[model samples]
Target: MAGGNFMHRVLSYVINEVVVNGLANSPAFQRFAVRTSKTLEDISVKASKKRQELAEQIKEASRNFDSFKN
Candidate 1:
């Protein structure tokens, strides 16, 4: 039973080391990270623009309402 447990621990260690090193050196992972960052930046810009447009529209609507009341 002890030998079996030792072998299991060794196998687990090797598998974890291989996976961690492989991911750390992967170009595909780097590209994905960059692409995700750019996409988030683009989305943020669009959201900012839309927010500004909505604010302008609300201001214009308020002005129109004030003119109508007068």
Candidate 2:
């Protein structure tokens, strides 16, 4: 039982080391990060634009409502 536990820990450590090294050395991962970051930035900009449009629409609607009430 103790041997099994020791083997499990060793395998886990080796796997984690390999994965860390692989990621660190991978250009593909770096490119992926850059692409994902750019995509997120684009989405954020679009969202801000949409929010502004909605705000303007709401203001217009409010003005219309006020005039109706008057």
Q: Which candidate number has the best lDDT?
A: 2
lDDT for every model? 0.97, 0.98
User: Which residue pairs come into collision in candidate 1?
Assistant: none
Segments of candidate 1 deviating more than 4 angstroms: 1-21
Residue 24, candidate 2: C-alpha displacement in angstroms: 2.0
> lDDT (0-100) at residue 53 of candidate 1?
100
Badly placed stretches (over 4 Å) of model 2 are 1-10
Top model by TM-score, which number? 2
TM-score of each: 0.68, 0.74
